[model samples]
Target chain A: MEIIKSPDALKAALKATQGSVGFVPTMGALHIGHKTLIQAAREANDIVVVSIFVNPTQFLAGEDLESYPRRKEADEKICSLAGVDYLFYPDVSDMYGEDEVSLIAPDVRGYILEGTSRPGHFSGVLTVVNKLLNIVRPDRAYFGRKDAQQLMLIQTMVKNLFMDVEIVPCHTVRDSDGLALSSRNAYLSADERGEALKISRALTKASHLVGKGVLESDRLYAEMLAVLEPLEVEHVAIVNRAFTPLDTVEVGNTIILVEAVVGTTRLLDNVWI
Target chain B: MEIIKSPDALKAALKATQGSVGFVPTMGALHIGHKTLIQAAREANDIVVVSIFVNPTQFLAGEDLESYPRRKEADEKICSLAGVDYLFYPDVSDMYGEDEVSLIAPDVRGYILEGTSRPGHFSGVLTVVNKLLNIVRPDRAYFGRKDAQQLMLIQTMVKNLFMDVEIVPCHTVRDSDGLALSSRNAYLSADERGEALKISRALTKASHLVGKGVLESDRLYAEMLAVLEPLEVEHVAIVNRAFTPLDTVEVGNTIILVEAVVGTTRLLDNVWI
Candidate 1:
């Protein structure tokens, strides 16, 4: 794999790539979830470009921007093993500068659930994704369903911005214990690690309830809150595919989401029913 | 020339165009100023696309957005004569939607003379321009140097966003009477139109002073303001090409700008020295 840092160097190499190019953007500490995105990109595109930048903008003040883990050598090893073609690791300076034009997320959709808890998060996300998409210019970009709201916002941005790229929404990669794979999982203590499973379990329960015809959003959320009661629950929301809150779950059109704190780490998981 | 009203149709037509495309975005009443941009685009690219949208977002509550001139048939005739390949005139619905994302200009650069007088104007210009640039995806885009701050902001947007297209800055088109060509001039009464010539004339005086090696910005602006006096002048300022205020003009990198009101019509003109 050719590891590039400068935007110019990466853009130069991109000119030579033929056929379809699939891009997978991530924040290092490569795990199984990231592997899934890379594998999908590898299978579909003649060239695969994966970028690892721990975006500081998405983190609200007093959040974990400072301590976000970086395992560059291990990530390089993983990319090599995963048949990745290009690994782009750009510093914060390489990405943003002072007094820059920024993207503000849609009012209603941008400031609810995760966005509500972490204000101005999606704006940061949308802005960086725009910069990355413009830089990569990939024919197809892979994003995990794990960050359902993030996935929805990205899909919205690409469509709204008139960007010509396909978003391949891969299923969320999970552990054998049903815990969603996240680089932040490393921050979880052993006991908190076990409690984080409740997030996924709550999502699974909500899905099962929906399968059993529990359409009312309140009943399903109550059931989820019950399952997540032992942990510190943040919010339980039922939203449409577009992230709009719905009173009732509409199968194939609704996502049941849950966010909770296990010790000091915040975890999120969702299921589309 | 084809007239495209919908975003999808315009994007499709853009893809079908051959070789380099030069885009000139405007808001109707096609004046010689727009023609200068179109002519430059025609010379540089294989196809030239012009969009006339008087974006509402860029207008303040008391601004003339509702009354902005819409000379459609005349604009079409002008484009046909100018050899424009496609003319896109998107309605408000086609360009924006409910709860849309916003582009906020940087704080410092966003709250200066023009931005101070017309708060949030550049935000709207940047937003619509961003949308147009993405949809058109032209190889080169044209802008007049008459709106010095607008040109600088657009250039900043393209560079900060890492957009690959070349930005072609064309000289401001002038009338036989030394008035800068503008769509808003249509709003001016004949007497008001004669009074508006002072803006350009004042800028010419500043340009001459720079040529003669008088570099003090305060003294230079004082001379220009004197020329603009006896007319209702809004602002007269001297700054570097980057739009940052300069105590003394840097001959090779200075821009002197003027904004004046003739009756109720506001006019802007600038010179890059």
Candidate 2:
């Protein structure tokens, strides 16, 4: 696997390659979730390019901008093992400049859910993702369904902007105990880690109730809230595939999402029906 | 020449084409200025694509968007004569949707000069240009230096966003009497058309002064203002290539810009050293 850093080098590499390109963009400290994305890209395309840049603009001032995980050695090994054609490890300088042009998220949908919890987060994600997509010009870009809102917004952006790339949404990968894998998982202590399972448990409970014929969103949400008792819940939303609020669930198109403060770390999890 | 109206058709046309593509994006009503851009594109690339989209997002409320000229028959003839391979003509519905993701212009630079007169104008221009550029994905995109600030801002956007397309700046095309050609020229009455020559005359005086060793920006601006007498001059700015105000002109890197109202229509012109 070739490890590249500069944007120009990656562009040249992409230009020299002949077949369909698949890209998986991430921040370092790769987990099984990232592994799944890379594996999917590898199987689907002739070229698999993975970019590992800790984009600073995506983090708000008071957020974990400074303390975000950076395990370069481990990330490189993971890319090598996964048969990545190119690993684009660009620095902050390579990605951003002073007072640059930005992509603003949609006013209404962008400020709800995860965006409401972390203001300006989706804007940053969309901006970085746009730059990455323009740089790579891949045939298909892989994103994890674990970040359901992000994946949806990216799909919206590509469609709205008329960008010529397909967005492949991969299923969320989780731990054996059902906790969704996240880079922020590194920040949790053993006690917090155990507490984090409640987020996933809440979604699992929602899925169980829905399977047993409870289709009303309010009743399902109330019962799921019971499963997440004593935790500081940010929100428990029941929405359709378009992220629109659903009072009554549609069997094949429903999504139950849960986010909570587990100790000092925020954790998110969801189940799609 | 092939005429395409849908985004999907343009994308497919671009995909099927071989060799370097050069693009010229305009808002219909093609004049001599647009001709120069197309000619440049024709000479430089193996294939040439031109898009005529009067993007609504770039126009302010109460602006001339409704009254803007639509010369589809004339425009098609011009493209055909200029040897354009494809002419992309998309309507507002084909270009925009409700509550879409957009590109926001830079706060400091984007809000001055043309942006100062027309608030949020550059944001609309950048957004639409970004969409058009992505849709076409040309090797080189041609832009007229007539819209000096717009050209500069587009260059900055492409660089800051790491977009992989070359922006070829074409010289401003002008009439024999020195009025810069514009689609809005159709709006000017015969008497107003004669008065518009002062804009170019002012730039000419500034250029002459600079050639004779008068480099002070303030002194040069005063002389240019004198040439634009009996007119409601908006602004006479002397700046370097970076759009920074210069006390003294830097030969080979200076630009003197002028904007004035001739009767009811507003006009803009500039000269680069």
Candidate 3:
């Protein structure tokens, strides 16, 4: 795989490339989740491009911008092994300037659940994603369903902006214990890792309850809250595909989401029913 | 010219065509200015697409959105005569939804001058322009320099977002009497139309002064304001190409801008030195 650092260079490279391009954008420190996304991209297109940009704009002031994992060599190896055609690794300067035309997330959909806690986070994600998508000009872009809200918003952006790329959502990849794989998982201590399992456990419990014919949203929320007991849970939201509040679970349409703090690190996991 | 009223149809149409597309986006009034833009596109690309969308978001509340002049038949004829291959004329519903992923212009540059007077205007312009660009996916997009700030902001958006299209800046078209051609000129009465000529005259005066070697911004501003005397001049700005206020004209890198209210109609004109 050829690693490209500049946006202009990537554009030039892609211009010469034939056939459909599939892209998987990620922040470095790749795991099974990122691999799944990359694998999906690899299977679908003639050219596969993976971008490892730990975009600074997506992190809020107090967020872990500095401490975010960066394993460039390992990420390169992963992309090469996964058969990536281009690995875009750009500096913050290469992607952004002093003043920029930024994106604003939809007020309603973009401000609920994850957006409520991280107010401007989706906007940052959107701005960088937009830049990346334009730079790659992929025929299809792969995203893991682990970031359900983000995936939804990105899909919305693609539709609303009339962007000519398909968004392919791969299922969330998880560890044996069901902890959704995340780069932030690196921040978890040995004991904190054990605590993080409760997040997936809560989501599993919600899924089980739904399987047992418990469809009411309040009941699911209560049962999940019990599973997440004694943890500083940010929210245990049960919403439909649109992220709109649901009175009762809609079988294939509902998502049971949970966010909790394990030690100082926050972990998120959700199960789509 | 083929008139495509849906984005999907336009995209499908363009997909079948095997050549470079040049685009000109306008609010339909079929003026000489728009004709100039379309003509430029026709000369430069294998296929030319012109969109006539009076984007509602760009117009502030209480603005003349409802009263905005739209001459569909004339616009069709104009596009046909200008050798446009496709004319995309999507409805508001076709272009927007209830909630959307919108764009926000840069705080400093976007909220000055025209943006200051019409808050969130550039954001609206950026959003619509972004959508249109994505829908058309042209090789080169034509924009008149009459809306100088708008043109600059669009260029900035294209650069900052790493959009693929080249923004071709066309010279501002003017009437024989030196009045800048605008769709909004339809709103001006005969007397107001004559008054609007002073805006271009003031810009002309500034250009002549610069020709005589008066490089100071203050001197240019004073001379332009004097020529615009007794008129309700909004601002007489002497700035560099980047729209930053200049102390002294940088010869090849200066722009003299004038905005004045001709009766109830607002008119704008500028000259690049």
Q: Which candidate should be chosen as best, given TM-score against the real structure?
A: 3
* Models sorted by lDDT, best on top: 2, 3, 1
Clashes of 3: 0
Regions of candidate 2 where Cα sits further than 4 Å from its true position = none
* lDDT string, candidate 1, B187-268, tens digits: 8888888788888889888888878988888888889878888887778888887778899888788888888888878889
Tens-digit lDDT string for candidate 2 (B117-152): 888999999999999998998999999998998998
Model 3 residue runs over 4 Å out of place are none
| B-chain TM-score of model 1 | 0.96
Write down the TM-score of every candidate: 0.97, 0.97, 0.98
- DockQ head-to-head 1 vs 2, winner: 2
lDDT of 2 by residue, A1-273 (tens): 999989989999889989999999999889999999999999999999999988887888888878888999999999999999999999889988776789988987788898899888989999999999988999999999888888989999999998889999999998898889999998999988887888888888888888899899999889988888888999999888888999999989977888888877777878889
For every model in order, what is the iRMS?
A: 1.1, 0.9, 0.5
Name the lDDT value of residue A23 in candidate 1: 97
Q: List the residue pairs that clash in candidate 3.
A: none
Candidate 2 Cα deviation (angstroms), residue B228? 2.4
Model 3 C-alpha lDDT per residue in residues A1-273, reported as the tens digit of each score: 899999999999999989999999999899999999988888889999999999988888898889998998898998999999999999999999977899999999999888888899999999999999999999999998889899999999999999989999899999898889999999998888987888898888888888899998898888888878778898888888888888998988988888788887878888898
Q: Which candidate is the best by DockQ?
A: 3
| Clashing pairs for predicted structure model 2, backbone only | none
